[model samples]
Target: MGKSIRKISWVAFIASIFSFSWALGPSPLVFSSGNQKELWDELLKYKLWGRDALDFNNSNIHFTTVEGYAGTKKDFTLRNGNHIVNGHFVVGESFITDTGPHTFGDGYVRIGGDLVVTENAKNNTTFNDYVCVEGKEANPNNGVFKKGTPTLGSCPGFFPPLENDLDIPVLDLNKLSGTELADFNGGRTEHVNNGVLVIDGLPDNPEESRLKDIYIGELNINNNSTVLIHQNSSNNITRVFVNKFIYSDTEWDIKVSFDGETAIDDSTYAGTLLFYFHNGFTIPAGDRTLHGTYISNGDMILKDHLRMAGQLLSTSITIDADFNSEHFRYVPFDPPLVDPTAFANYILQEGIEGPQLINFELDRPAVIDVDLKYWFEVPTEEDVANYGEGLINANDLASGYPTSETNAKEVFFKKGQSKPTEEQTIVIIDDEFVEEFEILVLCVQIGVGASLPNGTTHQCFDLYIADDDIYLVPEVNEEFDFSVYENSEPKTVVGKVKATHEKNDSLTYAIVDGNELGTFSIDSNGQILVEKKENLDFESDLKQFVLVVEVSTIFNKKATTQVTINVLDVNEKPVFKKGADVVVDENSGEYFEEEWATERFSGSNELNNGKGQNENHPERPGEPQTFKFIVKYTDVR
Candidate 1:
């Protein structure tokens, strides 16, 4: 690519650091052409032509026509009527020979005006080259900038004069609406007296659309008029050229605003806005505003001679001194895309919010929302209706389309109806309930080429989540168990249960019963043992009972057993009977048998004395004295 022809850095630095060339009024133009090489030969003949020539290979410029010396060229001056410099114009050495008092500046160079050569004793060649300058006029009308073909040391003389009879194209300003003008085709134009000049009409040709894409070239407004440009096309405006009146003592100015309004302060030009007049031209000195609107996806190329009085708020600015001899470049401004995570957090950090739409759908209708904070993407119904479903992806979520404020949420996808084979499914569960909830996640396998009894072709298994862990159902007890008796009391009983599904966790145990006869204790080893308590009632007549043992894992699982206790009986008390004698039969007084009737151990009164234990002394009849006896019974241990 050709190196972009911008103003020389040194020239710009000089122009910025010091003031020069004011004597020439404004900018002056001298056209030259003809197979570039031939034009350079003619230009080199001038005295005021620049002494420096570029060293580029296959060079087009042979000499700098702006340089010259005084006292070596003819003493020339300007006339009042129509004047033209048909050939190379330059000055000789001594810079000033036949002119009035002159001002010399650090970074300034003066050209134009008829050449004045000095006569000296040494150099005899009085006239070195030709030079022309506009006559000093009391009132210099704004000059005209004309375009023509190339020529050698001058503009093409054969070309027709500029179409001066042209009329300003007119349009109904009211017809243009919404800050946009269209349907133009270059057939109509709105003449702006003041304020902004916005050219939104369609180009005269679609090919021009390429030139206007994302940019509209700088507009040349009528005297005292301003232009504000923006574009939705592809081409970016590289520069702007203006033609206006040249005042010997005054300056030219302009301004620009990016989005309209008062975006920038006025800018000033050191020269006049005119292009003709080889000797008398002016560079603006005051300031003007540059109001422009930036394209979302384009850059700008600002030309030179445009100065900012206030702020240069823009993406960038560029200047060129050559192309069409203008100094203004403007282009569309584009904003940056934000990071998805940061964008999401910016939208959802404060509160529980619903899905947010991030981008727009093109072609088919679609809208997508993204929670970048959690890396979540959601598609709306509009998107599904237009783009089918699930068309929004991570990339789209990151774009945040439509507007920067997150209001525009629409976009399109190519094949929204197609299922994505690579996406992984996730099951969201509340972490807080993991301990108590018995969640059964069924793993359903759909067989490829099989049919079930019910005509379905699928199989499923249940997985139970218990004890803060996952397990398959239908587990069995597989641990070895040994039960030994210590003095007729139960000892340790050990075992382990195997789960159907292999899960990573440890077994836990709890004893469900202990007070009842059948209740037992289970240790951490999954062991069960009966507790022994002394002095427990063991009588058969007393109420008999048993112990019940229940064991299970941490989640209320249980395997049970019964423990029995035998009740036995022993003697508790004893009783004795008292002997009754024959005293009651005394009245009958039956004759006593031989030997004084000693009493048959039944202790009859006839053989007993007053003592409770009867020991017979004599037998007698009649008076019967009561004899008392006691019956006693004792409890045995």
Candidate 2:
């Protein structure tokens, strides 16, 4: 019941002469081929066809002719296990090792068909005893094909067309101004002048031109320049789309790098970089190294001494350079090309037909019964919107939850059945709005029922019914600066946080952590106001504090941004200390006279002796009594 072992077959062809109809549901697939050539021709009609690696669990495959091929155009990799190919299993030339030549197909490969290597075969790894070539000559140059008994049957024969088409919005370079593009790079909008950006040679400041997920009509790199595509996170992929082409003068001169190093081979120097080209990609002449995946719709021309670690997928390839296999490795996780038209058509058509057919096949034979359980759902509008904004919580979506029931669908095989037909199909119907359906298949031995578990597997696919185009989250403007003088008037308008959504959608604004510190407040109009002026002291508080403002749509979808408020310090008047009573002996006239003279000279004579005659005081004794009087003074300012 392993998810990888499930064999979903598509009707490739029907017997040429005979045909039958089903009274109910869809009709079964039937094929009759006059020769192997006819069978191969029919199979090629499908976008994808053949047996997965898990199909060899209990049986061996036989490759009868050199032309007899099965599998996908995409690269297939075998990690560290012995895989059996009973008959002739012809695959595409792109088959290569995930590790190195010595580690490719580390396990045994037993074949039963007349081993034939096609012109497209291009592997140099040695299979050693791992491959038991039975019929034809097995050479290192052609590939390891050893003669062995056939255990597995022929390939699944037919497979459904891939859902390559998904309607993803493409960026229009002409519509976007240079300032918009620079904003995407987390740079000041004014860095790019006019509507175009040009780098004649190596940038004097590399940080000035760093960007990701942007569209460039034409990019020309000269004079040993470097272009970096930064990965948002370890798992997040960053892509740079070039509408026309990428031009460079020398091979190793114009280097392309990634922010993080390659996970393969534990290399500390190389990073991940992905470039998608609408046209061709010209590899410069000289020794060069590329670490990520390069996808092109047109042909890729490679020059001398090119070393790569990821993958290259194009309409065609032309190699004029020396490929260093030691440094070059294959990466299977490259993103596939999407056809939006096909995706829309598939969704519109399938939406009315309920659930399409899903086939389940066991890798190993067992006398068991299978039960289908609801696994999960996908294309959640909230999740999709959050993912676009880099706020997706993978754990929340992965938590086991039953999305929907099977709704009385027919199961080809039932409980208490022993080794049922391998080609049984199941009809799946779920909720209409659900864009993806995941189901878990549980296999239990006969008489055990559901008490004990034998094997469990799960599969998920997009229903493709969600209307993602219309459900857009608001876009909030980022980074606002609010300057204020220390001890300014209260209730002053600092700045406004602005955001926009669809024309018809209503929005409300609020500060995220507004209540934590009573420094600022925002109204529904996003007008930020100072609440307390006394708290805005430049010396006592930080020079700047960030305010996180969020704008939410009526439907609860929201976007957030940060604002910084700077406080400017101003000079203030000096303060004076209160004076205390001072007692001086009358005999100490010299000291008193000196102090009085100093205070008068300094213009700080705020002291008084009781001898002064005022309206409320009578004249003291003659010549001012020489008594020890108290002197009180305040510091002069």
Candidate 3:
């Protein structure tokens, strides 16, 4: 019954949030021993965590079901980020998209197994970040987000072997007064009232400090009697552990949250009440308003016309569904689930990003996972295989400023894996970046169950990181060959000198060489250009030139590179003046015929004589008188 209580919470929270029934509550109460008491308070760490979580606490493991849910934020800091679970979350009911779009995020969800949603969930869900399931998405067509699924791990949770142990501290209901019974609060819950086993909340224990559960018997709050769970500014939770069952017949609801900040001030808050039933629980028939996390070790049946902002965790959960009938709103644990570690009171750290390493020493070889807001409990070897390796969730996406950059992944240790060479395992975080201010990072859950000698089952921590960015030296290189016509327009850009600089430095450029012909130039932006295009000739003595440019940053770091410039040849068209008219006569083997001839033209030239006398086409006449000219002449000077 001990571990069963803890495991019960695992499946309990995921199976059903609010229901009033108990298939196992009474049996555990009768035979509840110290063993059963051990396994207490392991509410489905995330989405779900039980042998039969979200499985409707069925007779077997086949059918897991969920009717409604919510979680939509970007930061996992205050329970506003991704709500990741290592187990399977199943929704058995099928509702249409219009009455749908169940919100399970701030960011998104990353789980190991398949997230099977009933058919209706396909088009109705809104995911800020993709709901990544390593296994399979039964209705893959659902939700906007399907990115960032983890291939890291499966949640390792201890299943409640027997059931919740309700026989602890022997609650003796005989010596209790009406005021103490009606309004239960502090004190021990071990007393034997005459013969009947009733609770009086007064069994002496040396360490009667901090918070303890108020044990009450079978309670029926009918006739619209509202149960009030007290809450103060400093304390926002109250645990009520019952041995039998709790039933509410009227529309009045029970406050059932252990993390509600304003439960007492405003009835609207998830009240500081954790109503735990060792057997079963219910608000039979119809009830509209409820606030808190309802937990059970037995079966739970949900009625109609209900509106709640609480959580449901039970061994077996069943909700009566009707079209347009049920509504469940999600509000992060008001004060969220913090560390339950012995020394959770001492964990606030500060440091710089460096070659720093954090080492973990394991007592035995088992799976260990770093709970970066993604894991509620340490994940097992089985958990890793399902979700491979990826970012589990984001605290702020680390982009509250720019807002949408994902850069955090949940880490895990392999099960039965070999021991480390040094200690057991080591993790290092080294980032070089420039930041305006220090950043505070939060990893809400951190522990490896009993795997570590001094480890607790659960813990949380915060760390501040200082800015440490480094600037490197500047690098410059040669701007390669570029071609330009023999005559290009002055001030035309031929090529550009380029280089790399750090620290947002400004670089200036100047031509160090290339003036051998005084025809090349460079601008401040490193543009290579020509000053006098006419001076650059492919056939001239200066057919090619080398330009050496220098570039320096604001820090005065200098570098020079050689840029080769080649002048390209542009072909000039041949000029022709009306060649001396050629005359030819027919039969001019001896007859006169226009023939190509070389003659002095005052300049070097070659000409073709037109209108060759018709030697082939004996006689032909045309009004336009288009003539064919054939020229084969020698050079003339």
Candidate 4:
């Protein structure tokens, strides 16, 4: 039966006013009020009739009344009434209150302004067409109509359509986290990469019987539902797992980048076009950081050890393969031509380090052995004809078959089982040897020296040596001579040597000294000296002399020492004679100085006016010619 539409009941108010008895009994009540005052009056009277059975039944009846600004205080004293309205119920803001716990028929009763009970009101469609039914067109007048009319009444033959009752608790996908969404045994449809799948929602305490099917469309997990991947269902029979997949329509292959977002399970995978994967997917090395793009999709099984270096944008990548044995035939078929040797070479040469490659071995001999088939490349027909068509037989692939040919070998891998080793040894070459050399030692000192009349003068030395062999002494030596009065110009010496035979070579020089005033040699046995002139001048005090001599060898090795020549003090002055033999004390200081002075005192008597002129005053003219006393002496120090 079509559920009848009803209004919000006023009996709730009736019960509130009459607390002690069941005045309106437990009958379905329908009430209407044009305004509030009349409604309250009728409710009061309904409560007053609660003392008797007849009154209770009579109150079970329904009633409705409307009054405008007439201000007529009419009271509705129904000895027995089911529903009643006694006041002017204004529209728009009128309200109904629930006085107590009341049970009514499934029929809905509404009191709001143009309200529809079932349809979700988040987006209002009823209010879009709401209009007031004036006094002449309300209820008994136009409210009742023939079947098929806009205001159609219920008809037995003309069946009234009814909507299915659905009271689904909406799940705020945004509110759930990845872990919280693990087991979703619900009646709602699930979202998969393909499209969607229907699922059942479990009862609060679900058993097999309580699992009800539900269909959902266009489902999306809320940000709060951070579960990128999760398995749903507690039972072992059926399990629902959800994973995130990126849908790309671009022509060129696109890679996914994960900034910081994560998927369920601590699994990592790379994604590509062919295989859907989870944690074992490959990703290009350089990509932007963002979530949502994953190289692979699907479930992943992690074994002993796994090392992935790419960006694991999404949940994980699954690697799943199974064999079909029922289709096997004994027909003599050429095994797929393959280069297992080359494959093995590739594995050993290009394989990534770590547990990237898995190997399986069994102790007992199996009934059959399984091997992968390979194809080799050929550039020409002659090459194919020369080498001939290389074919591998089933016997070559699987072993353990009866040698007698009675028993055939059936080779197949168990579901979810991986091949031990692909008959390939993988070796990753890492560190490389780069030839490098280091310099043991380096020193540079270039020297050039010349002998002069005054002394041997040499310029700053420049010598450098380097080699991977024995150390070589300087091939060039700088010498100096000074034995004449003419000024000698400075000479420079620069040279270097290289190591020989020995890996590391160093430069060492023999120590030498200067004994000749100006003649010197850089060799080990040489000596430098500054000769004293035939006639030398000295005055006042003792005069000290100093001279610098330098000695150097190969590799710029050098040593400097100061020589001294003291000239005795004598009362003499330097006299330069033209065209005469000139001499120079090469080791003496360039310039010289001496001190000489004389002290004298005189005494004299002046006139009586200047009697006894100050003896302390110095002799002056005229005024007194104050030459008191005089003494003189010549001294030199």
Question: What is the lDDT of every predicted structure here?
Answer: 0.26, 0.38, 0.39, 0.22
Best by lDDT: 3
List the candidate 4 regions with Cα displacement exceeding 4 Å. Answer: 1-537, 540-542, 546-548, 553-556, 559-562, 566-624, 627-637
lDDT of residue 483 for candidate 3 = 73
Residues 509-613 of candidate 2 have per-residue lDDT tens digits of 888863466878888888888887767767664678777888886545778888888888766433323433344533344333324321211223233432322
- lDDT, candidate 1, residue 632? 30
Q: What is the TM-score of each candidate against the true structure?
A: 0.19, 0.28, 0.31, 0.15
TM-score of 2: 0.28
Candidate 3, which segments miss by more than 4 Å at Cα? 1-128, 132-208, 230-237, 246-248, 256-263, 266-272, 285-292, 305-310, 321-637
Query: lDDT score, residue 206, model 4?
Result: 35
lDDT of 1 by residue, 1-637 (tens): 0111111222232233221110111011122223332222222222222221101111111222122111112222321111112222332221222211111211111222222323221121122232222222111122211221112222233221111121111122344443222322232334445455554322245343212221111223444555544322222222222222223222223333334433232221111111111121223323333322221111123332343221121111222222111222211111011111222121111112233322211111111111111123233445434543223212222243232223422221222211111221222222332232221212221111111111111222111222223322324443323332322344434223223323433445554443444434556554555454232333324333343444444333445554343333334332223354434343443432322222212223433322333333355534456655442332222
Q: RMSD for each model, in Å, please? A: 35.9, 27.3, 28.7, 39.3
lDDT of 3 by residue, 1-637 (tens): 1111111112232233222111111211222244432222222122222222232211111111121221111101111111222222322222112224344443334444455544544554555443444455556555445444332233224211222232212233444466445533323332322121222212134133223346565455545545545333222334566666534465655443222322222223422345566565655666545555566666556654455544565555544342121234322222222222311222111233323222222233322222222211222344333532221112212222111114323334443332233321111233333331222223233222111111112222222222222123457765567777776988889888777775656677877776776687888888888888878866567777877888876434578888888888765443455555544444454433432343222222232243334354434532223345545443331
Off by over 4 Å in 2: 1-144, 147-153, 156-211, 230-236, 246-249, 253-266, 269-272, 331-637
Which lDDT value does model 2 have at 360? 35
Candidate that would win on TM-score: 3
